[model samples]
Target: MRRLIFWTTVVSGIAAAYLLYKKGVPPGTIASEVIANPVGTLIHEL
Candidate 1:
């Protein structure tokens, strides 16, 4: 169960990043934004 949860979260995060990229967000911006403020980035994205 723990393993399943971990994979699911990993896949979901990847999908989220891909979607952001498809929307024209730069990869560097995404990485920097996530590193600087993860919670804020998630909130802004959602």
Candidate 2:
């Protein structure tokens, strides 16, 4: 149902935001880091 989809999206977005904060990463940092050092950034993700 439409209600179900809306709630799922809201919950997931919050989860993602919290995860990013816990990792000490601000949004958009990944893309900039990647351009500077692709391999290092990818390894850090793992």
Q: Number of the top candidate by lDDT?
A: 1
Evaluated with TM-score, which candidate comes out highest?
A: 1
Superposed by TM-score, candidate 2 places the C-alpha of residue 5 at a distance from the truth, in angstroms, of: 0.2
Q: How does each model score on TM-score?
A: 0.59, 0.56
Clashing pairs in 2: none
Q: What is every candidate's alpha-carbon RMSD to the true fold?
A: 3.4, 8.6
Off by over 4 Å in 1: 32-46
TM-score of 1: 0.59
Question: Tens-digit lDDT track for model 2 on 1-46?
Answer: 9998767655555555555556888668644564455444544555
RMSD score of candidate 1 (Å): 3.4
Model 1 per-residue lDDT tens digits across residues 1-46? 9998767656556655765677899999777765665555555677
In candidate 1, position 29 carries an lDDT of 78
lDDT of 1 at 42: 54
